[model samples]
Structure formats: structure tokens, C-alpha cells
Target chain A: MTRRKEKTELVPKEKQPISSQAGEPTRPGVFYSPAVDIFQTEEDLVIVADMPGVAPGDLNVDLEDSVLTVTGKVDEPDSDWKLRYREYGIGGYTRRFTLSDKIDQSGIEAKLVNGVLTVRLPKADALKPRKVLVKAA
Target chain B: MTVLRTHRFNDIWQEMNRWQQHMGDLFGERDYSKNACGVFPPINTYDNGESYIVLAEIPGISLDDLDITATATQLTLKGERSPNNDIADRSYHRAERDHGSFNRTIDLGQPIDPDKIDARFENGVLEIVLPRAAHALPRQITVKN
Candidate 1:
């Protein structure tokens, strides 16, 4: 999913708006909530978000007070093309998720590829399934 | 300065009708067909004076899984997505992403040079450049004084 550009100008028109037919202003200093899938296993919780047109270097992932935030800045393609129509807006992406106390924040790992961002959060030691010893009767 | 055509969904163009029909199959949102996509990769169309550029976003989809076809005035995209569950534990606590196949055809609203079309897929975004045909271009009228 692409970011939704606000109906304002984030970029100078330079006489470009005259050709726009998308019905919405797209200079897009706006940030959008990306579509995401969240899932968990016994050992780890994973999150995947769709942020097309965002490069890997433009992302920021930070954790504070057990809250995780992922932000991606989209680069407007440098071209002379004019917007004629659009099905999805274009801008940056930012979303946040709260991590449970059982999560090991330091062990979290994230990767972005083909415009998909995947984050893995490992479970704390206390939350892992453990084997118990029983005395033979 | 020449005023470029900026028509929205006000007029019913033949091309929009065919494109709307295809959109209705995957999304029954009626006129919203002129907008977003539910299961399909959302696309945007751009243009210069010479060609039409169609851009589609397909994150989490591998390039090898996509197939694109183009005509003189239309484009079709077909693809399948099977997300990689890279972790060891196969159990899923929650799943929101839908994975499967999608096929979409778009009417460009102008005849193009099908053979000269240039397509590039990078970073999960597919940009297709369809060059406008010679006859479809605006011809500058010369005055005979």
C-alpha cells in the first residue's frame, strides 16, 4: 500500500498542478498508516507492513516504554511526469505497536525488502515454554 | 500554455467502463473502482507529453511471480503472492495479510506504441511506460498566411 498524500502541497508546484487529474493535491508532506499483518508464535511475535516506494535506508524503528514505532519516508520520484490519475496516494508511512512485557526488546530484528517491512520480537526467557522434571513414583 | 485534460470521474469513457468491470470482479465497491483496491495491487497513472506511465505497488511479492502484458491501448497484470514465513515456529497467532493471485487490466485511454513500451519493476513498484502512438499525439496546426 502507498502512503496517502494530504490534499495540500508539500512540494512547490513550479507550474505542475495544471496537468493533475487525480482530483487530490499530492505534494504530500503527509504521513500515512501502512497496512500491516501481525502474528505471533510461541517464541516470537512478527509484524509485516506494506510500504511501497520506500527505500530501506529511509526507515526508522525505535522502541520506548515498550511501544514500538516504524516510520518510512517515501521519496517522490524525480521526473517531469504529471499525475493523470491514481488509485493510491503517495507519501511516507508511520505506525506504532505496543510490545507486551513478555517481549525481549533488545532482541528485536527488522528487515525491509521489495517495499515490505518485517519485524521480529523474541519472547522473554520467562515466557518461553520450559520442560519440568517429575519424580518417578 | 496548453491546458491539459483534467477530467475526473464525471464522464463515462469506454476505457473506464472496461477497467471498472475488471475492478468490480475483485472489488464490488461500485464507483470506488475509480479508487482503491482490496486484494489487488493499487496502481497510479502518470503522463508526459509523449507517453503514459502506469505504476503499481506489490510489496512482499517476488518479481519472478509477476507477469505483465500490454497492447496498443491497454495493459494487463497478473501475479501471485505467497509471503515468506521465515521463522522456525509455523504457528500463527494472528494473520491479516491476504495472499493469492490477482489479475488486472487497465485501458490507457489512448493508443500507444505497444512495441516501444518500457517496463521496470524495482523495490516492489512496477513502472510501465507506454509511448503514445504517432496519430494520437497533438498535431500543431500551421497557419497558411
Candidate 2:
């Protein structure tokens, strides 16, 4: 049975603001916004984000009250040499997405590979289209 | 006296121009490097007295797809990031990732030993270490007692 494909809907930029959680201590330095790509398949919605310098152990993905958040902590390079020239600085990454009811929250999966994080949100079974047989009388 | 005064003014003017150029390189709309077509990967370079370390953010790229070449005073990185082919069946709601080929060249301002350079790619970041040439290393002569 071929299921109808649905287009993935990304949370609008205004709705994805960086919100501070209660009791979470604010760390000094900047938190950069990672570049992301959101797409949908027949079975799931996929999100890919670029977050370099973030190890798998340092990444956190949490879902609370329909809000999905991804955070990665990156430590500054430790070297004794003084910096003579710089083009970029090290920083952490934070991004959030509001999920819809169509997603199966329990079946969601995430993987980190080569500094890229891919999150798959499986569609609820009810949302999956079923092919029905027609009877000719 | 007039020649000296004009020379000093010219020196100050050149200094100001250099400062402006540096600022432009930092905050310009487009990269000042040869790879000006795309801005997928951003790089940072640092000099640590003995070697120059360069860090580039290039997520989603396989190590085999990346190329690096270094000379005494210059380094070049060339790579191509193929777009996700699995997403062909799905429609994109937000497509911000850029995929294409890019070549970036960096001038280290000091001579380095190409044979001593080392490169590593981890978690989507590429790091290159270029050690300064023996002649470029600072040397101190002992004072006679």
C-alpha cells in the first residue's frame, strides 16, 4: 500500500525563539544558531542540523509539552600558544521546534554523525494513510 | 622637513586603510577569500608561536570528499558536499543547508614547513596544523659573560 506523502512543516522562526528554562544557569559566552534542514517522508519528519565541535556526549535532545529542544555544548580549544589571528570563535548551539500531534513522540529517534545531528519524528499510526480494497457488486 | 612630514602622513593613512580592510574581512557580507560564491563553511585560523592551526566547520561532509594542500605560506582547502539524496521523495519545509563545491585559500603571513603539516577531521570540523619553518622560529643568542 502506497501512503500519501505529507510535507513537513517547520516551526516558524518567530515561534522558535531562544527561551530560557527555569533553574537553568545561564552560561557565559554566545550560543550560535545551527543551520537546519527539515523534510518529510511518508513515514516520518526528518530534521538535520549542522553543529560542529559538538561530541555525542555533549549533546542533549529533550521533548517537553510538545516543544522539542536540541542543545550542544562545545568547549573552547585549550592551547598554550597565544592567538595571533582569528576568523571565528568557539560557541555552543541551541535550537527548538514545536511538534504537532501528528508525530509519534514515543517513536522519535536521533543520531549524531560527523558533527551532524539527524532527528526522525515518526508519524502517528493514525496519520498514516491506508489503501482500501474496493468491491465490485 | 616637508618630505619627512609627508612620509609620516602617508604611513598613518596606510595604517588606517589596513585596519579598515581587516574589519571588512571580518564582517563583510561575503567572504573575502577566493571561494566567494558560497558561504557554507566558515573557518578560523590561529597562530600558536610554533604552528598555525586552522579550524573549518564543514558538517555532513565525508572525509574522503575533502582535500587539503599546504605550502610554506599558504593553505588551500577544496571540498564538495552532496545534497541528501534520500530526501528526494519528501518535500522540504525548510531547506537552509547549502550543498556544492568550494575552494578556500588562506595566507598564513609566515612561512611554514609543508612536510610538517597535519590535518584531522572530527565531528564535521576540519583542523589543519602548519608548523613554521625552522628559519622562521625565533632564536635567542646567549649573551657573553
Residue B24, candidate 1: how far off, in angstroms? 22
Report the lDDT tens digits of candidate 1 across residue range A1-137. 32223222111101111123433534457666677777777888888887778888988999999999898887776478887776766778777788889998899999999888989999999989899899999
Q: What is the lDDT, from 0 to 100, of the residue A84 in candidate 1? A: 73
Each model's fraction of native contacts: 0.54, 0.57
Give me the runs in candidate 2 sitting further than 4 Å from their true place.
A1-25, A133-137, B1-40
The TM-score that candidate 2 achieves is 0.77
Residue pairs clashing in model 2 are: none
Cα distance off (Å), candidate 2, residue A123:
0.6
lDDT of 1 at A44: 82
Over the stretch B1-145, how does candidate 1's per-residue lDDT look in tens digits? 9989664776578668867777866685544334563537778788889999988877777878889898887899887777564655556555555567778889899899999989887666888989999999999999999
